[model samples]
Target: MPLASDPIRALHSLLRSTLRITVTDGRIFLGAFVGTDKPMNILLTETEEFRLGPGENPNGRFVGQVMIPWKMITKIEAQESVVQTRNQLDRDVRAGYIM
Candidate 1:
């Protein structure tokens, strides 16, 4: 894991790919898999939420920029690799992604 905690990977990945993330609550989000943590909490942007939960409002809709808790992540599918452009790297550097 260790992919969460900031916006670098989220921003970079947002530029490159879309992700299908499923949560334990039976909610699924199709969006850019922007960030994740060691516990596998997820962050997504431009999301369409497929609500399978009990709540009606949360069922089958789109939500922008969502954070899924570590306890909630069930699965994630990425159709393509996340690209790391030079611009992204520069941003990462400025943001302290550098070691």
Candidate 2:
């Protein structure tokens, strides 16, 4: 199947199902792909708290929230979902859903 035929599915294939997002301003957030708009903008929820700065001990950790704009994103890392989705898509295409 052409990559553009199913852009959302392609995104589901390309982007991390479990994303580790780092904001340009140096904040780190991780969560499931709750939502997104084209141009790669994203929305993530179910975030956990993380501590900033280079430190040996995590003493000043603060509760973090999800809802960062894509413009603030500096990096995104894909996790287990990459392999899982690829395998699943392969199966689906073999069954003729993706053609």
- Judging by lDDT against the true structure, name the best candidate: 1
Off by over 4 Å in 1: 1-15, 52-59, 80-99
State the number of backbone clashes in model 1: 3
Which pairs in model 1 have colliding backbones? 4-36, 10-34, 51-60
Candidate 2 residues 59-82, lDDT tens each? 434334466677888887657556
Candidate 2 lDDT for residue 79: 76
Q: What number of backbone clashes does candidate 2 have, counting pairs of residues 3 or more apart or in separate chains? A: 0
What lDDT would candidate 2 get against the real structure?
0.65
Off by over 4 Å in 2: 1-7, 13-16, 55-65, 91-99
Q: State in Å the error of residue 12, model 1.
A: 7.4
Give the Å error, residue 16, model 2: 9.1
Top TM-score hit: 2
lDDT of 1 by residue, 13-91 (tens): 4543787878887778888766766766677788898875465665567789998887777787766334334345556
